[model samples]
Target: MKTPEPNACLDRLYRETGLTLRQFAQDVNRLGTERGTPLKYREPSVYQWLQGHMPREAVRPLILEALARRLHRPVTSSEAGFPSSPDQLKQPASTVQGLIHLGREDMDPSRRAVLGTGLFSVALTIPGWPDVVGRMKAIKTDPQRRIGQSEVQAVSAMTDRLSDLDGEFGGRYARPMAAAFLVNTVAPYLKASASSETRKSMMSAASFLCYLTGWMAVDEGAHGRAQEYYVKGLELAGASGDRRAYCHILRGMSVQAANLGHGTPAVRLANAAAEVSPESSPRMRAFLAGQQAHSYALAGEPTNAWNSLREAERAVNQAEGQLGTFGGFSSATLAYCTAEVRHALGDAKGSVKSLKEHFPLRDSTDTQRSKLLFSSLLAERQLEIGHLEAACATWNTVLDDYPALHSGRVDEKVAKIRTLLSPYRANSIARQTAERSRELLVK
Candidate 1:
């Protein structure tokens, strides 16, 4: 029998990670679980992979992601001694090409299950302002076509309409439509000849749309897919020199990290967003700082968390007379941030109080989906703080709208209602709440 040569490239990368064979195996297994596919690799599996045996194709990305997380940067298949998969071989060469590819994949129902396999890496390389400004690759322009401010306005308007739909309903249905628009309408516009000013405007408009699409993905719990869209948005925002848009997208990425309970990355991303744009308005400052407060709390930095929260409060107070900001950051939003901060810091009672304060401050323009999600959170906290009847009352309100919504996150919360109330089944209200949740789950 012939002896296979050891994988020198994989060996080198593995050494750089400073992980023992068993540690490396455990990392990959942990990441696989995060991606919803639990893995059980052991030291023997790592030894085989290092000894010139190819890892399973499905396990390659998890290995790369583990390495990336350890090294604090992206790790490619080639760099890790893995042969390029068919998808990697055909990777899009430019930002626009990549966006089109992503949109097409998202629009295809058959590809979605595959798309959901993407792993959200804590060390994913986020492009900085200097790294991406004017960085769009040379696109093959369509000689017969041209775009102007009107095209830019159309894209922006469509994004706003899509946002409204996502807010009222859920991303489950709105996302496919957004994907179609990106592939059909926006991709062509990106390739059409246009004046420099018009081109930047279009890119900026498209960037915001990308952010919205990623936000919708987050709503559906397709987190890894959401990170891909957010990175594309950041690239486009930087290419167009739209600092506001870039900062906004970075903040959105931070929100995603925080939502997934990855505190370190969340804090890093939030700080980057706040620091990168030095010319932000007070409202924008508040928007950024509120997220910073949440991220800091999650990371267990009590002093930093409290400081960031105070900064957000002051900034929002200063922003009172300003016209609506990018995310409509207001007193209500500040209150919600306060609730998140308190909760993360283990002050359950305070968290519930801040959450209660958030409701009355909300205006008519707020999204129904948010109202329900936050209400669910409030109920959970109310239960935690021994307000069983109050929790039941809040949950009943969520049930009224739960049947109509199709959010994965909302579904997760609704399902938990049963588990949380199970021990309290002797109480009439708790039993009724559990029954209501069971009925919904059965459907």
Candidate 2:
């Protein structure tokens, strides 16, 4: 029998799952590893899948397994468009069209869909997406009348609430809640009346809302949607003449590009951020440098990564000198950059150390959710390096204290741990942890 085209398979998968290519790849990888198949769900493989090339036999099973795990039910190849035999593969075009027809019936309107449910709940937990507070600080506030003050304050308060919800209820709750604020409250205000001062504030708030929305899309592994939101954020920031906001948007773009394996563009964008952020705070400069270092590391340019890391350190050291002008750098912020650099450099111990050093300094409020996330990321890195006990201990601590911190960035960490621990599932402790996490999901 003739082989099904890769694009046909890909189109079918999207139709069946409502997942973007990247999201599907991540899901495939996570589930594959967990099920002991270990398929490589790289970008090229996904592109090939979209073009109708059947994934390796191993990949086909992994895809089915992942869907079963995600949907909490048994799934068959026939349900996925591949039949049991070669002769079955010779099915008519209507067979394929019928699947597409059914997929459409299950499709949710993008705008009306809840932000953090299902796949997005898992997506929200990946490291490095900027948060609402960081985006807000990037925008310049008006010196005169505080026209956008109420809205800014509202967003700030809402961001805090969402962060708390993320820590307590998980990403699934936090995402939709945050998205609701953006679409229902913030986006409407962006289209409202304003004076020059109010306009700046409005732009700042809108840019932040857009950034948050983009972050949510990123968590769900929606790269295209994330890119669109980041571009819109950049435009909003530019309208306010906030170069810092522009820098933040560029950073978001860099992250998305790096994740998509477009490391060259990622590095270029990071460099542009570093070069143009003249008045950035020391912590902010360090943040940019660290991102550049990460991009370079991913590009396999070790020398460049090292140089950028050094630049990041220098920025941090000089932070004291510029304290009066730029405000003292937060230890948590500094640690976040340091941890990211170490993780990218393959220094798992260093990553854990940096995160531990910074974890204590994080705010007790939701603003410190990023720090908690870094700690979880460090744990995952440690697990990667074969430090299972240490990793387990770290996750246990996080789970004990912030059980609700299950979504946004924490879910990624959990998924990684789940994969790592899968090998030891027969071990009682590992089994307990896995079951605990699964149980938490239901809550």
Candidate 3:
């Protein structure tokens, strides 16, 4: 049976509102808050609507209530584009494509688009999606041997491969593969009848895979998907009794919330992470503090950002004092966070400085791709500040080295640059760079 399309439901809701996109979102936000369920209506949320995506689960009900207020009538879940329960969601015959389609429908629109666009590039880098039937067979009949040293080594090798793919190809290209491996390989082993030590190792491996998947999803701009993965990772980490991995997942969730502009939630999540395990290593504490600082920066709380950043730095210092290494917190990760926080605070120059520091530490092969992405971000900031020539030059560098990363984000970034440079089309360099990017985009 064909499942209902979310767009059809959304179209009906919009008709009931009788308002344009902006008006509808405003009304929804206002009514939603008045009804005691606040909804965030940011630009990215608006972008989701334009792409024909509906919010999932409780969000749908909140939106419907807002619409009902606007229309002066009652609305139901059926009218708002959602299945009433898991049973309905399960009723449809599930082909792989069907599953993907339904998953897309349930996902936030921006996330769906990000995943759809990135799937091709990411799938090519990892093993193909598992055959569900084959996976079931393996789960049912696989050997019950305890996880040995070899299994730990294998898991480590896989994690390294995932990390490399994330750096070289972008997160969109790595997440699904990680997800597949988790569902097909790791989950089964975790559930197997094995020694406690083996089960712990399996859970740890699965937690790491889940964390990687979450990170990749975040990179692809799928905040909701990233959140789900992180939550699952947190649960697995708990089962493994791995405090360090739990801290990592918490940090990841905070980052996702911050990226989505939910700074308060991000701060709360980060604080909770830090509080839960007081005796976590200095490096782990620093990582958590860095994430909290990022959340504060997004919240426009500069004092908090500065304080947390200082705390993170102090923690790093103490770790260095104890053992010449900063626990497991790598310099690259620290530099990336510094750049991110600066960018969020609208300090393009500071962001650029952090990026410069980070660039030297990135792998040689990743240099071009990383620079292209950073330059694109810097170019946007420059354009915001009315530096047209600098913006144009930055975008030119991005387009010139675009293929290095195979990133959908690069395409989106280039598009933004083109839009910014449109007014300066008569200028030779701007026109040439814009046209070249347009041509590459077309191909």
Candidate 4:
């Protein structure tokens, strides 16, 4: 039998990473765990891969991602001595075309489970402003169709209505509808010819809807899918020269990373968002700074976190009575961000106080999903401080609204409530809350 030559490409990339064989294997194993498929590889496995032994197909992405993280750039399969995956082999040719493919897959009930299986990768490459800004190549337009500002306005109006539904119900029930809309209505519009002004307007509106859809995906606990949508949104935003939407999408990505407890990437993304748009309105500044504070706290940079928090507070104060900013940065939002920072920095009681401050500031504009999610967080912190009865009361409030919302995040919190109260099963309020949580979980 002929001996296969060593994988020179893999060896080259591995050498560039400068990691010990054991470290490389460990990194891959860690990434596998992050992907919910734990691995037990060691130095021998790494050596074998460098020696032309192919890793399992499913494991290749983990290896690529690990290398990408170490090398600080994208490491494609071909660069790592692996054949292109099916997805890559059939990759979409353009930004709009890719959006169509993603939306179509998301809209398909049969593909839903498969899409849910995509793993969130910390090493995923995000395009910078310079890389994507105003660089969308002209796409082939449908000669038979033409659109105008009315079509763009229609898309914007529909996005607003969808956002309301997502807030009132939950992403699980709303995301599919969004996907259907994107594929059925929006994608075709992108292919329809229009004046340059009208085209840019439509792209801007589509970018916002994409961000909303991605936000909904986050609520549904589909982080990988959310990232995909967010990237597309960023592309569209840049293509249309909409700096505000581009910054907004990047900030949204930061929020998603921070919520998933990925501190470093979260901080990187938040900084990118803030850095790209220095002349943004005070409210926009507050929104970006608040997220930066949370990311810094999660990354354990207490000084930076507090500084960012103060900046956010100052920005919010400066924006008082300013009405034109659309990102909705307010005192309530600042308080919530403060609570998150405090919690991340190990001040549980302070977090509880901040959360309390947040609740009263919230008005009719806040989503029901957020209201319940924050209430559940407050309950968890209350329980953490041994205030069992107080925790129970707060949890009851969440339960009152839980059944009506189909959010994966809210459901996760309710499940945790049951577990947190299990030790206090003898207490009546605790038992009742736990029981109700179990009932809801069953339903």
The per-model lDDT (C-alpha) reads: 0.88, 0.60, 0.62, 0.88
Listed in order, each prediction's TM-score against the native is 0.89, 0.60, 0.67, 0.89
Model 3 sits at a Cα RMSD from the real structure of: 10.2
Steric overlap count per candidate: 0, 16, 1, 0
Residue range 232-346, candidate 1, lDDT tens digits? 9998898899988899899999999998887788999999998887476778888888999999999899899999899889988888663332474888899999999999999
After TM-score superposition, what is the CA distance of residue 430 in candidate 3 from its true location, in Å?
1.9
**What is the total number of backbone clashes in candidate 1?**
0
User: Residue 342: error of model 1 in Å?
Assistant: 1.3
Worst 10 residues of 1 by lDDT: 320-329
lDDT of 2 at 134: 28
Candidate 3 C-alpha lDDT tens digits along 246-294: 7667666776667656576677677867776537667776778888888
Give the per-residue lDDT of model 2 (tens digit) for 56-153.
66567566655554553455666665545453467633211322222232233354243212221111211122332223323333244334577767
Clashing pairs for predicted structure model 1, backbone only: none
- Please give the TM-score that candidate 4 achieves against the real structure: 0.89
Q: Cα deviation of 121 in candidate 4 (Å)?
A: 2.0
Model 1 stretches astray by more than 4 angstroms: 1-30, 40-54, 67-92, 321-326
| Poorest lDDT segment (10 consecutive residues) of candidate 4 | 320-329
